[model samples]
Target: MHKNFTHILTSLVVVIAITSCDIGDNKDVNPASSFLKIYDSHQFDHAIGPVDVVQTDTEGYLLLGNYRRDDTNFLGTYIASVDSRGEFIRNTYVQGSNVHPVGKFLLLGGQRYFVSMDAVGLQGYLNQVDDSARVVSTIALGVTYPMYAENDGTDQFILLSYNSVDATTVLSLVSADGSIANQSAFGIGAGQSVEEPIIDHFTRTGRELPFFAGRASSGLYYLNGFYNYTLSLLFSDLSDNNPTGVVQGQQDEGGVSGLLSLDGGQFAVSRFNFGDSYTNALATLNASGTTSSNDIQSNPMLEWEVDAKVKMISLTLDGVGYVVIGTTTKNQQIVLHFYDQTTGNYVAVDYLGFSSPYQLGAIEVTADNGLAILGSIQVAGKFQRLCLFKVSEGELLDLVQ
Candidate 1:
């Protein structure tokens, strides 16, 4: 439940005529003009990448990511607020050993919270911040790789994490004030490990259903204690902690990087295959957690041997399609692929880069039918700084036409 940051510019006027430049192919497209603004983190020597972005009720934007003090092992989590015009309002950092923010902004009971993990990934903290980006409280949690968190439309939310010790998937129903209410664990069989659980809810038959996807060991037992890897999907009722269905992919080894709910028991997932060479694929699933369409590989845009990896995937607010973001192994440039959810067809692809390689972290549809992409841009061949791109909805649709 990574909150969409597209709502941040609700107060800003949408200018359909703004011109933009595509980094790859140097083509001039109409939607390219919709590139609104870009923000950079000047405080740190290197801003790793944005983990999440959210638009506040007051029309401001909150960003969560990591920053490095230098080219050393010192990594810190950062939270910042920006005005509707992409102007920085306030910025703060939680200094820790190799800290990386996980999940997105959580607005519950009229408060804002952001989650992150430490170097070892075993310990993490949820920071409560105000509109001014000031930390109000920090609640610690014992979890590694905090994958996803979704509210139950009440005072509680279900958090997905990985238990590094036992290699089990952990699900916890926690209160809005950062207190655990109930918890459950799912073991994917002995010698099999699970990681990167992404969760979302979709309305089907007048009821909202919660679904999750992640990577798990293929369960192909080896002589000692080895197992192949594959992607997994499951449908769960967070209220009672009951899992109704589970689905696993046929790929030899891969992990789900992004997930989006398309409603009516349908959703899309972005997966990275690590079986032989690095490849990416997109698939759609039905209510039963089963694949509804064939695996759509990166071959549509790049060859299978190009080594493309999808880092994030997000649905358009309209739920008609989704956008996939990642980096190409050769150029290391950030690449974005847009697809129609209904036909599962590729609409367009865009690349972004500065002087050095760009790493895309997160993307969300805006209130005005645009997209807000969060990532890091290398500056002067030295520092990697946080960067945000605002693309208008008109620009997005133009590419399809």
Candidate 2:
């Protein structure tokens, strides 16, 4: 399953385009019949990409992340606001040269926060933008990638920073106005960083933890390390380190490079098992930083053991639970998992697969009640055209149709 890492690197680039969206969740309906392409760019110029889409509470979506003009090029942070119909309302680009942020734009309360991990020296800034993609406020966190931003549920933001040099992690509480209220670091020389650290969910009380899934000292096997909310250390023993528990489990866990939080105190760490053998396992966390004691506790959620290598996973649990999974398959085939929020189970839906491969770069669910898919399409076998897929509640339900 070892691929030419060099070639697969192109999957990291995201391109953008706009189109009209039809509303409706009837699974038996044809999504394309009412699907319109609002913004489509055959090239990356004047085009923003590597975009992370988030829906606002007002039914508008904020497309946040960074975009590059070309290979080895860096684009500053970007936040584009789109209506529920997937039409662009406004787009804003942050002021930075080499600051290419690498994680998804996080939404807390009514504000949108994105970190500039690609910026050197200073960590990055947390941004607050309005529905029109205007920067409301910005706060700086020293040297942290995949910064975990969450609202304490009371107009407060809990920001976590991971310091690879000291092998330590820190947590801070910033007010809604982008001011730091409290800060603390738990681990000193415990957390390991392989290139960068990945932070997951935070509680309304300003608690968060980092989930590690990098290689072990052996350099042959993989390891999973869990850090506490206060950035304290936990899960030290490698005895139970096997991601799937069975140490020699046939499934390869090395490709799992990121972690994400699910609503109701659950977090799913994604691992690319290489090739079509990709698997995402759900881990339930307790207030004390321990995971549920279930072997493969929940369903694998996604099991694409054929042609797709899942690259990014987006979860929306506020309303009806839905998952948008992006992949590296040449066909650009994306899988949407819809579940009953109350039951934490899939809602028995069917999605018609697109015949040709489409490169799905990044997918985000906005607070405005819509979903945005950003990526490039190969036209006539030579054009890397930017394309977007917008789905409403009804349009989502129409997938099964």
Best by lDDT: 1
- lDDT values for all models: 0.51, 0.44
Ten-residue region with minimum lDDT total, candidate 1: 219-228
Q: Report lDDT (Cα) of residue 393, candidate 1.
A: 62
Give me the runs in candidate 1 sitting further than 4 Å from their true place. Answer: 1-44, 68-74, 96-98, 118-121, 142-145, 151-154, 188-231, 238-252, 275-330
Error of 1 at 85 (Å): 2.0
How does each model score on TM-score?
0.67, 0.59
Cα lDDT of model 2 by residue, 57-122, tens digit: 676566665555333334556666767555667666566533555344555665566655445454
Model 1 scores a C-alpha lDDT of: 0.51
Query: What does the lDDT come to for candidate 2?
Result: 0.44
Per-residue error for 268 in candidate 1, Å, reads 1.7
RMSD of each: 10.7, 10.4
Backbone Cα, N, C clashes tallied per candidate = 6, 36
